[model samples]
Target: MTRRSITFRLLRALLVLLALTVTALLTASFWQQRERVSTAELVERAKAHDVRIVRDSWGVPHIFGAKDSDVAFGIGYAHAEDDYATIQDVTLAIRGRLAMSKGSEAAPGDYVVSLLNIWPSVEQRYLRDLPEDVRAVMEAYADGVNLYGAEHPDQVAPSALPFTGQDVAAGFLFKMPFFYGLDKTLKQVFEGKAELVKTPTGSNGVAVAPVRSSDGATRLLVNSHQPYTGAVAWYEAVLESDEGWHVAGGFFPGSPFMLHGHNEHLGWANTVNAPDLVDVYQLTINPDNPDQYRLDGQWRDLEQSTAWLWVKLWGPLLLPVPQTVYRSEHGPVLRTEQGDFAIRYAGMDEIRGGLQVYRLNKARNLQEWQAAMALQAVPALNYIYADERGNIGYVYNGMFPDRQAGSDWRGTLPGDRSELIWTGYLPPERTPQLWNPPSGLVFNANATPFHASEPQDDLQPADFAPSMGMQTNMTNRAQRLQETYGADRSISRDEFRTYKYDLTYSERSALVATVQQMLALDAQDDAVLQAAQAQLQQWDQRSDRPNRIGALAVLAAMPVVRASEQQLPAVDLRESLLKAAANLQQHFGRLDPEWGEVNRIMRGKEDLAIDGSYDTLRSVWGEEQPDGRLKAVAGDTYILFVEWDKQGHLSSDSIHQFGSATLDPASPHYADQLPLFVEKKTKPVWFTEAQLAGHIEREYRPGEVTLGK
Candidate 1:
């Protein structure tokens, strides 16, 4: 052939190859985006669900339905309307498909889903273990989400269609472990060694019986500290059904059940409680075979599977990355450069979490609630309960593994010994719990269960097994509760509300101790240091917005508190103080700006000064900014106050950091409640139809034009 003709043929072949590759990608994308169910079919499914969603003036959904499943459907649709993006993300994360849209940064979470065998367990037991009623609710919820996606195709991403009941079930399975810091353990293992950091994040739950109340009313504080926005952030809702599934409380993005709030007769609050529920086992790898491990004098092959993560390279293109997932007899195994470690965490292969939450939501009184608690499906959380009957209780809830008592459960154990693996959890009765204490008060501030109530009414350390690994740490919020609420003989309604929004740090708080230490520091001839110390000394240990000296003291103490929380070595407080002073002077031209001027809560164009600091009872944890301001990010996202008067009449008030439009900035409800939240005020919950009659902004059924408002 002629040289020119040969070159032309080679160029033509290359062009043809490129076209073929492009066609293949487009074809794959089309298949991934294909309609799982038509919008018409989804609407038909909605018709089967007799549910009505009523949006109150604050845009909180009050769902009325014929059955519990119908209520669940309404919850899914209403929550999706406000925060579908987060719900979609939760679904993707549970399905091990997050990397398909979020790119490489989310690959680890996707891989963890496979490595943990989350889907396999869900697929297996979602049908068998979960009862028909629970399964119906989950499936109906998924249907509602699917219906919304079908109607709003523009907002739907590829592979985001056809959310299933199993997805909802697996969400609890995957996300629950992270509540106790399993994700931190995985990160440490992946880095090289398992040097886990235990940072007990904030939340406060307090319940007071009528006996302790001056007005003869039972009170419950459902204050859960979470990020201002994300998968785990709180969304407020009120659900009612003919099947007795009435509840008014907070829910996570993808959850159908009210995580914490009040039902008609009783209500409870959840705070993150970390006991050592996760165990790491160092496996002995066989020399002859890399995939085999030594277990109980036998060479056992590690069950292996490949997790194919479809990472988004760009638009219409996905790169399939194959990662080998390993599992040992202990549980999910992670082979790292340090060693192959197997993790057996609480609620592993336990898929009945939704069932337990459903039962708890339907519980009419304390006895029924305790019966639901006995399920033990929920792995971790501190539950503070109060009801109409003047009963109050606290449970340091955990599915603590019944491990051999002699072993150091906190450290890595031998994977070779099958006997070391725990097959069951302790019964609910063995859990550290206090019911109707003589003090008429029960509370948890991410503190030890032993000191949950008055010293006399508290659970003793001797009562709980050391093998249970219950946390013994205390928090400043807990200290303040003891000083204020515990010290009070008869708390009035106003006092109860005032104490919840308490901005004063306890005299025993770490912030006070740190301030005292800072005041004692030798200025060392530095005028700036002397001035900063003087300002800190003026701190009244209050994080109120009007406090001028609090800006300097809390700013300086943040580094120490943060370091301690993250299990890092103590930061140099002197250096922190100096740096804080310099930043304050540089940004505000003074070292003592008002606390409000330094701390803010901003949403959209609205920026407002907020109260509360690092460990205060008000609890506003903020993120530092370049402008020397602390932007409130977490700690006190959702707050609920529930009360039952002597006549057994129920009432509630709640506040969210932002409004009902969780991801929609354009909506009027987006920041409508921000002012109230920043000002430490709450709107009435309007739990009953009679209360909601004059308050509703709009009402409609699912698959209607009322969405995306």
Candidate 2:
């Protein structure tokens, strides 16, 4: 054949080959799509477990089963029925895939998760690190969530599918770090700055022994200030199994066990402690090779990983956003405009937090509880424990780092020096703890752990090193707690409850000091300013209902306190004060209005003034709306007070800012607890099987219960 004729014939053959290849690609794509797990299959798997969930009048589920796994499965299904959206979000967040489910708005969160090496840590440690029983329970819980998503296809995201045991473990690995302020450290490094500032967010916990109570019963207050709604909001449940799994208290959306609450034998509470668990190190990059960083004066290549985040923009469309994350011998690497920094955070390589918590829930005595705490997997929190045996204890627990004995480790450290890097944590026993103090009372309002108990019974700060980064500042709540409970040698059950619900700040509180200073300001021709001063002068220092002076003080101080760490501008403070006065006048037609009238807890069609303020005994704080009203956001969500008699009998009561059903507005439980919460009342929390039976509204296993009144 001629050369031209051969070329034309070859081109024709190539076209045919291309057409066949396209057809094959299309066929494969279709097959892959069809192979994806369907909602029906997932639902069936979820229902395979024999777990029963009983709901009470308040919509709190009491899960029962023959095995621990069964109880976890039921708990997951019940929680999903109430808040599948949040559960989905939390799971996605843990997997570092939130951007895929929530869109670009979630990209930053995904980046942080990847930068923290969340999944790698879980993958490397999950199977071996998790106890056998705990793994079973977590797997069962994952199955239940997957089943719920399967049964309700419309509720599940497209790419999201049947979760596995690993997903459950990831949840703990991803969330626990943030509990101890690791997120704040990452944010600081990501912003290309280094400065340690005290945080305003905090929680309160207090435990009184029988000696301190007139009723001869030990009391433990579980008051954790968290966001009013969303993943961290409180959901009350009682998990029971003939196999010895029994608990009642608050848990987050996807948690398998009660995070803080009481069992038949004892009860406990947790307050966020800001002991420094994270350290940032400035790496010294080799001049000749940019990828190499010096550690211990030796240059080493940094381990790098590329993260692909599915940023959902709108509808089914998504963009794959890529981020370069690095890791080194220290920990996760953070890239910023200033340079690269490595973070060494507590529990970065630990995967036993859930196991430890599970053990704590099942502990029958103080010894067992102490053993659970010895796991040292939990990074930071002040735990207050009380038992029916009239035992009360407080522990400033954390996986504190054993840094170089004599080094300035509090601020940024030189990454080049491996000596400054820590690979393990101090044993739990070495951490500060006080058991059965002579004072008969212990408390921590997110303050320094050294002052957790009465003066003579408190822990000695000198015992711990400065490298531990223990907090030194006393919060207003801590001061108020000392002023009210510290002076009293003994307290009555009634007095204990009343003290926990105290809504007044001490006259000498920092907030009070600031208010007094503002009131002392010299008055100019600004009528609004003069009116505000007059209102402040008449204040009673109480955040109670119908107290008009609180509005003026809170409004004036909001802007000043909300300002950045930089010093507040004098002109801005004056402007804010005048504006606040105008707002008060415009809203109430006077410069003074009841504190309750200005602040409120609003949900659905219900809106009412709430009696509380930040740092008050009954603390509540939030953002203001355009209509000149404060909308509750955080400060008071789930509260539990457990009292155990000398006879080892357990009884408790709890209140949630909002009711148990987090999603359905039509459910009777949607806002049933709001009135009690606003009124500072609590309903009895029943743990006994008989008590649960008496309050049962419905009982069934997952995929069996019908959703309706």
Candidate 3:
């Protein structure tokens, strides 16, 4: 989940200002030097019985197997065939061996892995904590990845061999909290390097129940705004087995279970939610002993460890970079400029993320789904759910620590007091939740949980403690959703689809506010500012291809929006406007350029002008290019629109910024969905066994399918 249901505007800006922060190039020499694995041996050891993979026309894998473990194995094999390089990169990052091949860029991530003590957490808890069935799925998936790596030595980092089940589990433990902005939090408090302009993280999720639908149907919008490429980006797949494991939706790289999507009976969408789950405690150090800290009126020895990173020095040679890490009772300690601050964030010692997701995949109804959510291993994400039973719901889910009532946990805490520490979380019922609201709708645009549904049915923020830091502000998208979706009663399925693609910025939006401020400026004294202000004032705030005002206003506010999540370089309204006007005149020979001309989507050899702006329901966040244009980099990555008809027949359609093969530019699937995405259209999702029969583009076993097939 990347969005909160409700939050305050001030905290939102500070949250943005606070933070910001992949891969080995495989070569022929690595292949030549390695002992290649035999395909026959892989076939013998994989144990993928009754596995039959049918790749749909869109090149999405629909894997079928006799057992649940077999389907997991097939998903591993199929996903590896599509994106083996990314699998290695994900696994490597988890194992803290990424620096061995990627060098300095990956070293910090490797070091964070050490600082978080993630591996030891996995080591201590993985085998013992995970249920045997879940462990089987993880182990089988890892084997599939290992088999792929064994077969294709050419495209892997040398240190990435021997892929294990822990790697798969670690990937979940590593990525879960980051999705909730843990990395951003780490950079703000620890790294001390504030990013000026960063791609923001947010998502859109809404569920419509039969009670409010015109045709008595249910709909769920699975739109997650993410970088078009990366570890957190979505990859679509359909996994099913005879053993009752059936799910289709999106998964990250190296995932065996769908992170968000639907099975036959139910489906859920995730938006990132930020509750005050992380606690920063200032440790009281011993006067004489540097390695000891005062806690509970007693000086305690800090646990010390060293992580050795094999940093790439040259070809086939890695330099060992040893980093010392310390831990106190407060958790992982960071020696900041001011003091040693320890972090006790949710999922710090988590290994059950995989299990939580697996249960969600296998859940048949809202009860099962809620039961699975009770695991509370995912830590945080805003969930919008819809089922065939005409039920629609929202859950502002988090592993909220049951901290003591006296202290201000929202701010820094006293590490010396054990009473300030929390040992458990509120039960599932205690988290903000809604079921079948009177309005029959639930939505979150990274806003507060208080406004998640119809006002009457919305969760009462007052019921929760102030220490939770639950947001109380509205995003441009959330405000717009209120104006549009909330205003609409008895929504049709077609209307639901159209509403999710709304591209208008709310009047309350920061971009619009910036423009308003520029308009209020005494621009009459400056010719350029006057001209720019006049143009922006004429804007209708629709980021469409032919809109002239959109180009100038979007560009004028682009700098600020890009850096919204971090400390911004004082962006003067008049200065920003004048610069934008100048860039427009210089780059395209006119200030009134079409929105698409300035905002574009660029892939390898495929560049096209795209529409949409940041924080819009139909969001598109662009990176400023050298030539004065903004290249679409993130926002609105994978979108899935699902509907259950009057008779309970399920149908789904989706679009991706890229294709199923996440990293392969040569594949036909790559860039295939761009036109659909840009056109505000969706491709049919073949969910049933009937849909899979003839729609397949290619079908073969993992080892049998050639690269780029």
Candidate 4:
């Protein structure tokens, strides 16, 4: 071969070698970077602190540590072991990165996150609004979650790694409003559609003072409902630290601190409260300049930014999707066919409710709890609290905007008026709250705060401002509570427990109303209809399993009754009844099938018959199967009964619809609680370490969490 050709060939070979070298170096650097930021390293650091988690026979974690932050770390680690996917999903959603993993379906959620400016606000307020101690707890929690992802690398999404304290903070800030129906409002804005038939989200929180309890013991029932498993499903844990953090109750996926449960001294429960905390301002925009909006008689520039969403195109391939977000003098702005509207919400700038919850958790008494609540970091909820001191209080808690009183606050306001933009909140005093009522009790089943107590001690509705948007709607559970307790001045412990699990639909309930409507219909000409009406009339308003009439009653009344309660009644109750009767007969080959045969509770490998209807005290709302039978989806998940004896000794009993290991089928806890839940039973909370000793399934530190053989 010629020397010139050989030289040329040699040079080309040299060039190819150089390119390969560079590529190898780049790949090595990427791997090194990932290794440098190893989340498992964070877990090792957490283990340096003294934290021990003891999983009881039921798979519930009883976490003990030297410090509160250590306990939080342990709880995070334990929760990840049970439901890592959900926890990761929650963090992904909060970071506006869910679209990157979940694709097109989750893009809307990412858009809303960016439109509402959640992460931006978190970034701005994380170090500013959140207290240092709260930040430490959240950081430890993030570290624990990251460690789990690091160890179980195959289980995590491609982009999710090294979860940060900011993720924990943002998760709390973003998901907190969902319990209060913020998602429903967002759906109205984005989809331009409202739910036709609305049923109240169920949570029955009742507190009875010592004076009202026959044995002079204070009792509180904490029953909050969510789907069987999801972002908001409850996971029970008992967290304790030598530094005085001892709490036992249920918490959501990403929350480091307990959501609703009790410390040794006192405990509280939360029910969703929807006051007018959000306002949409219709802005006058200049067509020529899209960035300009009118405010206070002058055209002003909108604060604009582009949020780049990394949408998943294929596996590991992300495509950039950019959306322009705008902010006006009022708040976050969105443009739609309706108009340019700005949403000014209470939690738009706040990211410190987690700290408030922590403070409430460590509270020792009613006064201490009240002091923590006065922070008002949480925008809205109904807080039902009880203490060892035999004091019970109910607060229709919300951040009441100090908006101008003369205008209709419930509807859209003009953005041009600067006064319409509320800059402050109503102080704690102005918010509707009752200390210890003369009736010695208070309850909220998503009902009006004005009727929280007995008639004599109930707050006068006329006294509060219309701008607060306090609901006047009553539910079957609320009416049942009132009639049960109001009938007698003092209630025994058994009665308190019995009433909580009562399966009777109240007389004032829409179920009764809808049934009455159906019975009143003229069916003289239709023999089939007469037979159905007669069966319905004999229902006895009971929802027990073997009751033949209840199956038909629940099927016929649930849809129409829920609608009637929400002011969206069915077109015809008689039509619904006829369809229900036909469905029942087709499925069971009889009009009067056993209630259990129709209504079932299905989980994992077990599908068992369940008793209860939508609005009954032992509420169970189920979805229909292909064969026309109903399978319970929601209504009751976690139920807790807290009682303090006359001598101030506290004992609590709790149960979950499913076991502690959320989605793990191999885990023994997956369905352990189902039988107890169906039979209306509760296991002891087992708060003290000594109480948990004999039941220990496994004990370990954060990285070392293991399932028992």
Candidate 5:
């Protein structure tokens, strides 16, 4: 062969070899995503669990079994039936493998999973610390999900199968810290930002004793505001087992226990509580060795590991990217452009959060419930309780760190001091809590725990150490609750429900202050601004659907409110007013459009007016849209009202922003509750068999789902 031909042939051969290597890598990645377990095996596992799933007319699952584990199995299968995709996503997120499916957008979450040492910690404590029964329930729930995945493989990710009990517990471990805004702190560190801002989102929990009720009935409002969809959204279900684990309430996608709702004798509501549960320490790195940080005047080696993130690049291709994870004596270490900082958060190395919830689910009374609370496994939340015995209580629940009293807990501390690193939590009895108050009412709206009840019954901030870092801010909902429920001496059932759906802002509300600021602006040449000011002056401070000026006032204040909540620079009143007025006129041809026209709750083929505004008791937080309407995104999602009469007979009602079939648009129950939810109405919760007798739409065992029921 000629020399030129020989060189060309060699080059061609090299190109072919490169193509073959690429194909082999792609094939290997694709194979990794394939399902390995057989459907028949999953079916056999399902058959082993003796559980019954009964779907009510509204498509809510009432799970029944001989044991709690069996009921948990039913819960898993039923929830998966409604939102299997979300469960798969939750699993992926907990596993720190979200980037494998969602691409680069989820890599940060994957990195956090490694940085926190979620898997290793879970593996260490899953069996050693969790009770045998709890582990069984978790494993059974996983088996139930596995069964569903195996049978309906098309509904889930190919690789999202064979879930285990460890995954369930890890989900709790991964998500608990973020409840108190740990993610925001991490984001600030990642972006090299200074300081952390505690902003109010939404949640309202209230408990009324018989003395406070007009008809001598104990009442509880289990209202938690979460995004209308995704991992944190509430899924409603009623679980019953022969082993005395009967309860009805909300469950997250992967959870087998009720996060909040009523058991046979009592019930509680959960609201997100912000406490100084997380501490960030600035590390002093050694000049000679980058891997060593100064602590206690000596160099300590930082623990290091590689986080191998399987990120999806495109179709059937995963890029393995390795990043270094570091840990100091304080806790997880984050190396940023600013410096290396260590985070020691509550619930760190704790895997008993799910166990705590499980114990709470089975607790029969206040004493048993308090024992569960003593676990201190759940990092943070405010729990408002009511029971069948006309008792009510409020617990501003958190695993508050026992830190040195002098240091600023809200700010970053020096890493060199070992004493600043808190190693234990205060006992639950010392937690800011109230029981059967003289005022007969307890409530929280993501507000100051010190003001949860009537002034006489409220906890004094002075009694607690300043190192606890309790929130001092009060929301409009909290102020309104004081004006409505707190002011009323004898609140009737109608009034209790009315107070929950209250659409009026308190006179002292920030919205009113913002409106006053807008009215004070110099609208010298701007006619729209002048008109908006005139509208605001005549406003009733109510976000009712029929109110015309309410739309203008809310829209004008939203920019400032959003900026304040996000810790961004303050928005100018003149600018906000002029922009809001102009946008309203453009969309509706008038500045005085009805609040209904602006605030909306829309679902598949259904668009309806929703009454409520930011921080109101009705609590509708909306997103601005191109059509000039505000679409309800969060606030007032899963609301439950439980009441026990003088005879101790329990009756409850609930409403969901969306219905039971959370993900399937084709399901009739998808948006069935939206209209009622918007109208401030509710459906009866069929807690007992007698109540559910005529409400059954379908019934079946796991792995034996009958079609066209």
Candidate 6:
């Protein structure tokens, strides 16, 4: 062929070859996309078991199956059916993928996950540290969540499908730290107040034995105050397996095990305890390079990772965002405007938290429970334990760090001093705990663990080193419990419940103290203030539902009490009182209105008066509304009263602030528990097969329950 003809032919052949290559690439991509499992297939696999979920009147699920894994699988499906969005959100948050789904608003959380080194711990220890049975249960749970995601394509976030067993483990690793106040510690570092890494918010838990109970039996009040609705809010479930897995208690959306509650042989409760489990070290950054930090007078490279977050700016569309996270030998490196700091927290290297909780669920007696506690996988919280044997106990529990014996650990430690770094945790036996106190009573109101029981039987601070960063503060709840329960050797069932629901703060309460100080203010200041003083003087210290003066007093004191400022002026207390009075007068034309008139619990179309106040037994949290009313948000989410007879037979009751179906307001179960919750009443908890049989409104396995179009 001529040269020109050959060139044209060569060009045509080259074009043909490129077209074939493009076709092959397109085919491969299409096949890869098709190979990814669909939602329906995942759902089908999830329903592969003969598991059954029975719902009671309040919509609480009582799951049953032939095996523990099957029961967990059912629980996953059931929980997903009610609150799949939250479950997905929690898992994604733990995986540091929330920003990918939620956008920039979730970037901080993603940053936190990376900064905390959540996944590294899990990846390093999840398999070796987690028990096989517990891993199976977690896998089943992941299967349930994946199955639900498969079946509900419309509800699933884009790129969030096919969850695996690791995702389940990651959830626990991601969330367990927050429960113990790791989030607050991170906040301290971010805000450049690293020295303020104190114990988290307080909580109350009491387990009374037969000798302490009027009915000659055991009673437990599982009262945990958390954000009313979220990943941390109380969600109740009863899991049963022929392999001996039976537990009923409040669990977060993504947890495979009950965080706190009862099994057949024993029951337990958790109160937020403040043991200093986390410490911050100000790293000496290399002036020559920002990426290297000095430790032991030698420069060390910082481990760096990019955190990709998806920020949801509008609706379905999400923008991919990335942030840098660093880690040093001290732990997660946090670079703030002030300087580079590293956080060393208890449980940072542990990943058996879920396994420990699962073992606790399967624990048959005090010994078994203690064995689980010995795992020390959980970094914080005080546990109140009681069993059918009438035994009662309390553990001011945490994986406490073994800091330098004489170092002042409460303040920021020097990053360059390698000796200051805690290398290991104090063994569980060495941790502060009390078992069967002579008084036959065990209680913890987020107070110092050294004072968890009767003064005679309480753990002494001298027993623990000051370097452990143990909390020394006592909340009003602890003070009241001591006055009420500690004063009485025997407590009646009604009285026990009454004390748990107490709305009146003691005369020496923090709120009362603030009010008293406010009343001591000079009245000659201003006209608006003098009228406010008149209202403050008439105030009674009761936070009861209809107390009028409570509104003004509480409103005024809220600012000073909840302030994050490093130093608050004493005069600000008086100012808050005056402002509170003005707020009440401006809104209601009078300083005194029933507390119920000022504080309400509203959801959808339902509005009702709520009882309780900050630190009261009835614990109600309210936020100011646009109309000047305080609306309840957290506090008093789910309340449980567990009772066991002399023969070890169990009967319990519970109530939730909201109904079981968190998603569908149209469902009858949506608000069924609210009235009972507000009335301080509880619906019977169906634990046994016979009990569940009688109360079950409907029973079905996964895929059996229809989602109507």
lDDT of 2 by residue, 93-149 (tens): 877778766777889998888887778878889888998899998989888887777
Clashes of each: 0, 0, 23, 0, 0, 11
lDDT of each: 0.87, 0.81, 0.82, 0.83, 0.89, 0.79
lDDT tens string, model 3, 414-524? 899998878888777788888888889899999988988778888886788776778776788888888788989989888898888887988887778877877888966
Over the full model, what C-alpha lDDT does candidate 1 score relative to the true structure?
0.87
Candidate with more favorable, higher lDDT: 3 or 6:
3
Give the C-alpha lDDT of model 4: 0.83
Q: Of the pair 1 and 3, which is ahead by lDDT?
A: 1
> Model 6, stretches more than 4 Å misplaced?
1-41, 193-202, 313-318, 564-571, 705-709
The TM-score measured for candidate 1 stands at: 0.95
The parts of candidate 2 lying over 4 Å away from their true place are 1-41, 193-200, 562-573, 705-709
Q: Ten residues in a row with the worst lDDT in model 6?
A: 193-202
TM-score of each: 0.95, 0.92, 0.92, 0.92, 0.95, 0.91
Superposition TM-score, candidate 6 onto the true structure: 0.91
- List the lowest-lDDT window of 10 residues for candidate 1: 192-201
**lDDT agreement of model 3 with the native:** 0.82
Residue 185, model 6, lDDT? 77
List the candidate 3 regions with Cα displacement exceeding 4 Å: 1-43, 561-570, 704-709
Per-residue C-alpha lDDT of model 1 across residues 414-517, encoded as one tens digit per residue: 88998899999999889889999988999999888888889999999888889998888888899999988999979999999899888887787777788788
Off by over 4 Å in 1: 1-33, 36-40, 193-200, 705-709
Best candidate according to lDDT: 5
Q: 285, model 5: CA deviation in Å?
A: 1.3
TM-score of model 3 (CA atoms): 0.92
Mind giving the per-residue lDDT tens digits that candidate 4 earns over 593-697?
999998999989999988777877787888899998888888888999999999989899899998999989998999999999999888988989888778888
